[model samples]
Target: MSEAAYQEKVLEVEPYGIEPIPREERHGRARQMFTIWFAINLNVVTWFTGFLGIEFGLSLKHAILAIIIGNLLGAAFLGLTSAVGPIAGQPLIPASKRAFGKIGVFGLSFLNLVNNIGWLAVNLVLAAMALQKILPLGYHSALLILTIATLLIAVYGYNFIHTFAHWMSIIIGILFIIMTVISVQNLPALLSQSAASNGEFNLGMFILAVAIAFSYQISYCPIGSDYSRYLPENTSGKKVWLASYLGALTVCIWLEILGTLTATLGMHAGPMDFFAKLMGVFTIPALITVILSIFPVNAMAIYSGGLAALAMGIPLKRWTSAIVCGGIGALLVSFGGGQLADTYKNFLLLLSYWIAPWLGVVLSDFFYYRSGLAQNSTTNGWAGITAFVIGVIVSVPFMSSVLYVGPLAEKYLGHADISYFLSLVVSALVYRVLLKFRSAAVPVKPLQFEE
Candidate 1:
C-alpha cells in the first residue's frame, strides 16, 4: 500500500486498449474545445454571491480582492493538475484511480455524483425562478423545464457536452458582459443614492468570501486531469496551462464583477433577485436566455459526476448513469431547496477535506515519489489515502463553529477554508511517514491506459 508500490502496480498495463478512439474526425479546436469546458464548469451558481456576497455586504473592492486571490490559487492548481489530461488519455475518475485505488474510487465516485446532483438541483432552482418571472408557469412547470433541458443534453455524452459547452460559454459570456456593462454604467448614480446606507463591510469577511470562491473550484482540480486526458499527448504544457488559467480567469472575473455589482444595487435583495432586476431591464427574453445558460454548465456536472461513478465500479454505462443520476437531481428540485448557502460553505470546507489533500498527494507523488514518472493502475497507495483521511479528521475541528478553543481560533477555524490548508500539511506529512514505514519493492512506471 506504499505510494511507490501502488503506483507501480496501477501503471502496469495489459497489451490491449479499453476504450478505442473513433475513426471519424472529431470536431473542435483546442481553444474552442477547452474554452467552453473551462468556462461553464468553472462558474457555478456559487459565483453569484446571492448567498455569500449580498449577505456579507461585500463591495466591488472586496469582490475584486477575493477573485484575485482565488484566481491566482485556482489557476496554479489548474496548471499543475490539468497536465494529467494529455498524459493519461482518460477522464478524472480513471486518473484518480491511480491515487485512490479501486476501492478509493467508491468514495470519490460517490462524492462526485453527489456534487453533480447538488449542482443540478441549484440550476433547477435558477431555471424555475426565472420561468416563474417570465411565464405563467408555477414552480412545478419551471422545474419540468429544467429537468427536460438537463436530460436532453446529458443523454448525448461527453462529445456533445464539450461542443455545446463551447458555444454556450461564448454566448453566456457575451450576454453577461452586456448586463455588467449596463450595471456599471448605472452604478455610480446608484451607489451615490446609497452612499449613506448602513452596512458593515469588513476585511475578514471579504477574505472569507474570496476563500469560498476559490474553494469552489479548488476541489475540482483533482478532476482536471480527467478532461486533459483526451487532449493530444503532444499538446504543450504551457498552452494547456495558459488555456485553462485564462479561460477560467476570464469567466470568473466577469461573474465576480456582475455578482458584486448586482449585490450592491440590490442591497435589499438576494443574488437571484439582482439577476431578476437585470433580466427585467433586458426584458423577459433575456432573462430566460441567461437562465437557459445553466444547461451547458449542468451538463458538465452530470458528465463529470457520471464518470466519477464509473471509475468507482458502477455497473452502468456513462449515458445510463448520467440519465439516472441527473433524474435524481431533477427530482430534488421538487423540494425547491438548492441548499446554495450550505453547499457553498460545505464546498469551501471540502476544499480542505478533498482538494488540498488530493493536491498534496499528487504533488508529493509526482515530484518527490514518482519523480514525474507515470504511475500504474493497481498500485494501492494506502499512504496517500491514509493521509487524506487524517486530513479530513484534523480538518473537522476547524470546520465546525462549536469546536473553537479561542476567539482567534474560532475566527480562523470557524470557516471551512481552514480545512483545505490544514489538510494539505497533515496529509503530506502522513503520506511521507507512511511511505517510510511501509516500503515496497517496485519501480514506478508511466500511467498505463486501461486495457
Candidate 2:
C-alpha cells in the first residue's frame, strides 16, 4: 500500500517509523508542540527533580537560580532539536543518521531505548506511589494499573497522543494553577523561614542542582523531534522552536519553584502527598490530578522507547513495542524496592552521564559539521562514536554518584558533579575538530521504503 494510504487507513496507528514522514501525513500546527511539551512536563517527576537541590543542602534562593539556569540551557537544546523534526520528517534516531552514520546511530538508539524505558519505569513508579496513597490499591496493583493506562494511550500512536496531550494540558494546567494559588498563599512566610542547616550555601550543592535540572530537560533530547515530525514541513521552524521552548520552560519553572517552596515549608512527603497537605479537604482532587498527569508523560516515554527500539532494528509494531517496554518497566517497579527519593536522584544523575555527551555530539554535528556537508552522503561514523567515547571517559573523573564519586569530583570544585558540563564541552569540541579532517563519501542511495 502507498504510505499515505496506510497512514489514512490506520489514523490511530503511527504508520511511519524510521522513514521520513510523507508530506500528506503531515498536518498540525506548531502550537500543538507547545501543549504536548507543556502537558508532558507537568509530571510529578519534574517536581521531584526540583526538590533534589533542596536535599543537596543548597539554600532555596540559590537552588531556584540553578533551576532557572539549568532549565533555560536544557530547554534551548530541546527546542532547537525539536525544530529538526519538521524539516527532516523523522524522529530523533533517523534524523541522527544524518550526522551519525546508519550504523553509528544504532548504538545510540539502543542506549536511547534503555533510557526511555528507565524513564518510563520511574514515571510509573511515581504515579503508582501517588495513586497508592490516595486509593486502597496495593503498590504493586497501582503500578500495574498506571502502566496499563499509559500503555493504552501510547499504543494508539501519534495523533491520539497529541490529542490527549492537548486536552490534558488544559485540564492539568487549570488544576495546577489552583494548587499553585493555594501554595502561594503561604509563600511569604516560607520565604522568610531559615534554610535548613543542611541547606547552608554550598557551591558543590549549587552546581549539582543545576546538573540535575539540566539533565531533566536534556534527557528529553532523544525524543524531542518525535512529537514534532507530524507537523507540516512548511511549519515555521522558529515558531516550533519558540513554542516548545516557552511551553516546557513555563511549566518547568512554575513546578520547580512550587516544588522548592514545598520543600522549604518542610513537606517531606512525595509530590502528591505534598499537594494533599496543602489542599486539605481537596486532597483527593489533588491526588487524582497528580495521578492523571502522569498519562501524557509516561505515554511519551513508552512511545519514544518503542520508536527507539525500532530504530535499533528491533522488529515490532509500535503498539507491540509499547506493550513490551511497558511490561519491562512494570516488572522493574514491582521488584525494585529502593526508596523513591534515592532512586530518583540516582536516575537523574545516571541520565546526565550519557545524555550530556550525546547532546554535545548531536548538536555539534547537526549545526556545525553536517550542515556544511552534502545532503545524502555517508557520514564518518567512527568520528562521532570515538568522540562520544572520549567524552564519556573525560566525564568519569568528574562524576558524583551514590555508586561512586570520582576522584577529581571530590578533589576539585568542592565535590560538585561537573561531569555533565565537562562531557558536553569536550564532546562538541572533539566532534567539530574531527569533522574538519574527515570527508563525506559519495551520496548513498536512500533506503527503499513505501514512504
Candidate 3:
C-alpha cells in the first residue's frame, strides 16, 4: 500500500516516534479502555499466574486476598500511567522522557524492550503448548501459526489492536463466563475440602503471592499508554483511569479466583486440561476461545516492543520493527523450548526487580516534581539513573530467587522476596531527595516532530 493510503486506513499513521500527537489527529473514546484491558487480561498466562499463587503455598482464602490486593495496587499505577496517554499524546517511552530526560529514558526503553520481547516469547510458548493439547499438531507447528497470526495484527498497529480487543472482550468474556459456570458446579465440594497447606499461615508465602500478582500488572506500565495515546486530548482523565482500572481489576480478580478454586479442588491441571474436564463434550469451543485470545495479547506485546525500540533511536518503521521483534521472539521460542520454563519464575522476579524501581522513579518525578506537566526537560539524567541503581543495589540483599537467594532474604525473611517493594520505596524516596538538591542543567523544551 502507498503511504497516503495506509495513513488513511489507520489513524496516526506516522507512529509519532518521540513526538507528541497533534490535536487534529487525536480521536477515540476513553471508555474503550474497558474492552482493551479486559481482553488483554483474559489468557492462559494470567490463569497460570493464579496457579503460581497456590504453588507458592497460599490457601484458597489467602490466595484470593493476595490476588485482590496485588491487582488493586497494580491497577492504580497502571491506570494513572495510562491516563497520561491522551494528555502527553505519545507512547509510554516518549511520555516518560519528560521525567527521565532524553538519555535517561533510554535506560527504561532498553529494559522495556527486553521485557516486551520476553513477554511475547513467554505468551507464544504457553499459547502454543495449550494449542498442542487441543490439536494433534506439534508445539513447533502451533508456535509458528500463532507467531504469524500475532505478527499480522501487530503490523497493522494501534487502531486495529483497539478494534480487535473490543470484539475479543465480548467473545472471550462470554466464553470464560460459561467456563466458570461449568467449573463452579464442583465449587461446593472444593470449598469444603481442606487446601494442602498443612493448616499453617505463612506470611512470607503470602507476600510472594502478592508480588507475583502485582508484578503481572506492573509489567504493563512501560506500555500502558500506547493504546490510549490516540484518544482525544479533552477526554476525561478520570474516565480513562476508571475504565482501565476497573476493567483490568475485575477480570484479574475473577480469573484468579477461578484458578484458585480449581487448584484447591486438586484439579491442578493446566488451563486446557481444567477446561476440558469441566466443559466435557463442549471442550472444542473452550479450546478455540483459548487459542483465539492469544492474538490480541501477544500483538500488544509485539506492538509496544517495537515502539520502545523506536524510542531508543532505532530508525525502522513501526511495522518493520514489529516484524523484527516478532521474528526474534519466534526464534527464541524455537530454540529455548523447555529451558524457558525453568526460568519463568526467575524471569518474573527479575521483571519486578527492575520495573518496581523504575515505576517508583517515574511516578515520583511526574507527581511530586513535575507538578503533572507532560513536558520534557533538560536535566542531568544521572541523578535519576543513580537513584535507580542504588535502589537495585539495596534490593539485592532482600531478593529471593531460584537463581540466587540474598543473604538477608534467606537468613531472616523465610525466603520471601520483598525486593520489589523495597526497591519501589527506596527509589521514590531517593529521587525526591536528589531532585531537591539538583537543578535542571538546560531549559525545558517541547518535543519536535515532522508533519
Q: lDDT of all the models against the reference?
A: 0.59, 0.78, 0.77
> Order of all candidates by lDDT, from best down to worst?
2, 3, 1
**Per-residue lDDT of model 2, residues 1-451, tens digit only:** 2446544232467666666777778888889889999999997777767777777877788989999998998898889778877776777666766567778788888878778777777777767777887789887888878887888888888888888999999999898888788888888777787343334478887887887787778888888989988778778878898999998998998899788877777777756667778888778778778888889988998889888888888898878887888887677667754255357546645655877887888777666532322254366577777788899999998888777688988988777888988898999899877876777632333222111
Report the lDDT tens digits of candidate 1 across residue range 1-451: 1112211121222111113222221123346435754557434364464235444555556556777777677666666666556655555455555456766767766776677677667677776676677778877777777777777776666555566677777777676666667667867765664464546666656656666666655766755764555455556656766777777666666666566655656545544566656555675655756575778777777767667666667677767777777777777667635445345444434433466776776555554433222454565757668878887678666543222332443565334345556777787787767756655514454333221
Largest lDDT belongs to which candidate? 2
Q: 155 in model 1: Cα distance from truth in Å? A: 2.1
Residue-wise lDDT of candidate 3 within 231-306, one digit each (tens)? 8777888889889998888988888888877777667565567777867877888788788777788999898988
Query: Alpha carbon lDDT of residue 9, candidate 2?
Result: 35
Greater TM-score among 1 and 2 belongs to: 2
Output the TM-score of candidate 3: 0.90
lDDT of 1 at 77: 69
TM-score per candidate, chains pooled: 0.81, 0.90, 0.90
